[model samples]
Target: MTTSTESPCWFTSSYSDHGGQCVEVATNLPGIIPVRDSKTPGGPVLNFRAEAFAAFVAGIKAP
Candidate 1:
């Protein structure tokens, strides 16, 4: 289980341009995905396994 401190780059969705209410995602880590609130960068981060993260994103995009 990794933490936000481990991720090097944090990026918010391009859709955030319209509004600031978007989640940020950090990748390039060893085997985890770091996610946090775009509004609170220093806030808590949620870590997920790569496979789990992919599934989560797929779920969000699924109809």
Candidate 2:
């Protein structure tokens, strides 16, 4: 778990326009992808391997 302060700028997913219930992502880190709740900017962050995070996103969008 990483803190929001430790990550660079984070951006909400485009899908977030549908509602505010979306996760924010920061990819400035070399090998880590920091994710946090958009509603809670200063909340806990879940760090995942960059590759793993990409795969997860792919899976979610897979039909």
Candidate 3:
């Protein structure tokens, strides 16, 4: 994947624990939501559509 000239502002979930099992997400880019392992900042990133990612999060919160 080609690197974007714009840098993403990554942030870990507020509920993240000290176990280092959390992931980071960057919403600075338009249309895409980038996710990466918090333990590996320089590692590969996974990109998902903004709407799709929102739906996924909602699904996770659903009972």
- Cα-based RMSD of the predictions, in order? 4.2, 4.8, 4.7
lDDT of 2: 0.81
The weakest ten consecutive residues by lDDT in model 1 span 1-10
TM-score-better candidate, 2 vs 3: 3
TM-scores of all predicted structures: 0.78, 0.77, 0.86
**Once superposed on the true structure, which residue ranges of model 1 sit more than 4 Å away at CA?**
1-6
Model 3: which residue pairs collide? none
| Model 1, position 29: C-alpha lDDT score | 80
Clashing residue pairs, backbone N/CA/C < 3 A, model 2: none
Which model scores highest in lDDT? 3
Ranking by TM-score: 3, 1, 2
Give the local distance difference test score of model 1: 0.80
Candidate 1: tens digits of C-alpha lDDT, residues 1-63: 244454458888775783768888877687788898888889998989989998998999999
- Which candidate number would show the highest TM-score if scored against the true structure? 3
